[model samples]
Target: MALYGLGMAKGLLLTFSYLFRKPFTTQYPEKRLTMSPRFRGNTFVWYEERCTGCASCAKACPLGIIRIVTHPRPRADVGNDYNVDVFDIDTGRCMFCALCVEACPYDALHMGGEFERASYRREDLVITLDQLRALPKKPQTQFRPHLETAGYKGDTELDEHDAGRWSL
Candidate 1:
């Protein structure tokens, strides 16, 4: 009957061993862990220069949280020939789906690694064009699937127009 308590003793010994070991959890705000390449953070990054205002990202969003407003550019020589006026994303309602990034024909949108997006007001959760543009730019390897499979190595001379189109 005394041997029946052996399991509990073993369990307690295992717990004590782990208690003496160095903790793996980092003290947030002071020490931060490097986010994985696949981490889906709350922040959204948009490259204004690369965006064509095609609204493909918006269409791909099932929640319709992404909103974009665009107007024709005055100069024909300019790339895309569209001036993005309003680009807003309601992060509060967002599901953190990477569909927007995958659907962007221009490869303009990317998932950011910033996870600390707590806000006091509901209105603060809405990310604007300026905010989106301010997010850190991640290499195509992070969001572009085709590029990821290609081992992120290839000709750097890809034309801007051709980069937007994704083909099967």
Candidate 2:
């Protein structure tokens, strides 16, 4: 009987404890939480101007999610116009390891920080080139801040201030 009473007392104490404690839940939609700088989100970017139609990202993807279709540029003197006609990423199979981004020698790809990628159907998750291109570009300075902070030697093409120039 004493043991039963003790158990009941403990349970009641736990119930009462919450009454005095602050609520942990936030009113979402009204409030938001900031993720870490390194947080990888579900936005895909294409530096269409920079891509050399290397097809490295497509080859590196283990799930075969990346597809590239290249065509010759209008002028014979100008190089091949590597347009991503059918760049489809099946979010259903994507591990988000950022291998595709790393494999891109031209820095044409990078991880974006927008994580709310819920979809009603599996087919909806498969992002098309038009959808990927529609996404707003993240500031170049936002990516790999550590490298910039350390003053690493590399392409000085993309700096913090020059981030907002690109559109589409």
Candidate 3:
């Protein structure tokens, strides 16, 4: 029967076709895939200037991974400015829920796009304030209002406003 070997021939042809096609698998270490605009990465970006030390982010964390310790600083206008003494997020315990980011009213907190957070010790995952501040600033696209109302509307483009309210 002519059809008997046709199936094998087609299978071989399909296999051979892949040789010329571009690979879908990325050579991870050498070539990294660009993360989506909405992707909630593990690294947290903290804008020290915008942070009011309200402890809102800490309270919103479901896992209690965020810990904030603030001390009052005498201010001429406000009477007392809350200076954030300790702002640490135990990333190991974090579930990447983005709850903390949502609770930040000042837009001081945002999730970064850096995912290469592998570490040998658990202590290394508990990100300190210094580490958070040291991270390169990224867009603050993940907002509570945007998320709740679905305002993102499939638009992943980060605008000036969305790009980490630094100037504000």
Candidate 4:
């Protein structure tokens, strides 16, 4: 019927109107898209020196993906009470909630801005203490307002001293 054809023509016109417009999707790999300030990315940046071995990050994780091992310090009263021996984060099952990052009282843990970590094996996704030590400390400003105030836009990697507002 002519009425049916009219509806079809309207749909075709709408499609054509948008066909020449700029696409909303970014050309990935060729051009990296900038994430928002509060984006909870998959990558994590941790500074061990600032960590107090309190296991606060592990306790705050809703998925229980973080596992920490600590030993009593020789002189507990001297500085930090415990010496962190192990800090493992199973990113394979992480939800990217950012709860652990916010719960760290010592400002040692932070969510990184990059999300390009793609691995074929599940074991490769498990981040150990050694791997954490090697990872670049490029922290995103999700909850830590101090990092944002310090002009950390999450684009560049920072050293331990500059990562947190209250340095360890």
Candidate 5:
């Protein structure tokens, strides 16, 4: 009969152990959690300097939310192989699958890390070429293993020729 009250005593001890501990609460807006290297945030980081106008990213999108317009400029050897006239990404319907980033052969596209993209209207969420050009170049390295292997922590911006000639 000595073991009769043993179960109850153990349960009581477990409850009391947590009774004096402080409750856990997140300090939202002030202290945000930094996403991991492979997080595909609500934004897209498109490098116009590296895009070859191949439209592979758009083709890879299962939701068909990516749009691109490019003029053939084969004669001129410059920033990109074609003159990208329009680039539009509808963020309102994106599923964050990261497939587009993987389809990019030139490594010109990467997922952004900022998640404060709450908007009042859907139209306001559409990422145009101009906005993409202006947004901070913070690649989250979602599916790009080379960047991760290169030790890109997604804390900084990626600039021109950052991938090097052959990538690491």
Candidate 6:
């Protein structure tokens, strides 16, 4: 009987403990919590004009989630160039290891820190070039030089010989 009474008292104390305790939940959307610097959220990258269509990213992806299609530039073009006709990344299968980003010789890809990746359908998770490009550049605190170099710099060509030179 004493043990039963003691258990009841403990339960009641725990219940009362919360009566004056401040609520830990914050109003989401309006009040967001800052993520830590090392947080690995959604994987995103810049489609910098420097992407040589070398297909290094596609090859580096272990899950084969990255798909890229390129077309030949006109022979009159001075430097090697290809039109990126298709670039798709299935976020559903991505492990976010950032191997693709590191494999890029032109430093075209980088990890972005946006964690709200909820989706209702699988197709919605497949990000396209336009969608990835539309993401706002992260603040300086999270900035990486590899990502900043994605801006358009007029017509330029990638040196084919240098594509395979980068170490992953």
Candidate with the greatest lDDT versus the true structure: 4
Instruction: Report the lDDT tens digits of candidate 2 across residue range 92-159.
Output: 77888888877776666766666678988888888788886676665233344444465532223343
TM-score, model 4 to reference: 0.88
| Backbone clashes, each candidate | 0, 0, 1, 0, 0, 0
TM-score of predicted structure 3: 0.76
Winner on lDDT between 2 and 4 is 4
What TM-score, over all chains together, does every model reach?
Answer: 0.79, 0.69, 0.76, 0.88, 0.83, 0.65
- In order, candidate lDDTs are 0.73, 0.66, 0.76, 0.85, 0.84, 0.66
CA lDDT for candidate 3: 0.76
lDDT of 2: 0.66
* Candidate 4 local lDDT, residue 21: 98
Q: By the lDDT metric, which is better: model 1 or model 2?
A: 1
lDDT (Cα, tens digit) per residue for candidate 3, span 72-137: 999998788899989889988888888888888887787766678999999999889889778767
Which is superior by lDDT, 1 or 5? 5
Between prediction 5 and prediction 6, the one with superior lDDT is 5
lDDT (Cα, 0-100) at 144 in candidate 6: 41
Clashes of 6: 0
lDDT of 4 by residue, 48-144 (tens): 8888899999999999999999998776568647788999999889988889999999789998766777999998888899988887778888888
Tens digits of per-residue lDDT for model 6 on 1-71? 99999999999999999999999998999998766543456757454466778889899999999999999
Ranking by TM-score: 4, 5, 1, 3, 2, 6
TM-score of 2: 0.69
Q: Identify the runs in model 2 with alpha carbons over 4 angstroms from their true place.
A: 1-18, 74-81, 139-168
Evaluation by TM-score, superior candidate among 2 and 3: 3
Candidate 3: segments with Cα more than 4 A from true spot: 1-17, 144-168
Write model 1 residue lDDT over 120-158, tens digit each, in one string: 998899999988766665433455666556553322323
Distance from true location, Cα of 98 in model 6, Å: 2.8
Clashing pairs in 2: none
Cα RMSDs, all models? 4.9, 5.9, 5.0, 2.0, 3.5, 7.8
Model 5 steric clash pairs: none
Task: Show where candidate 4 strays beyond 4 Å.
Answer: 1-3, 76-80
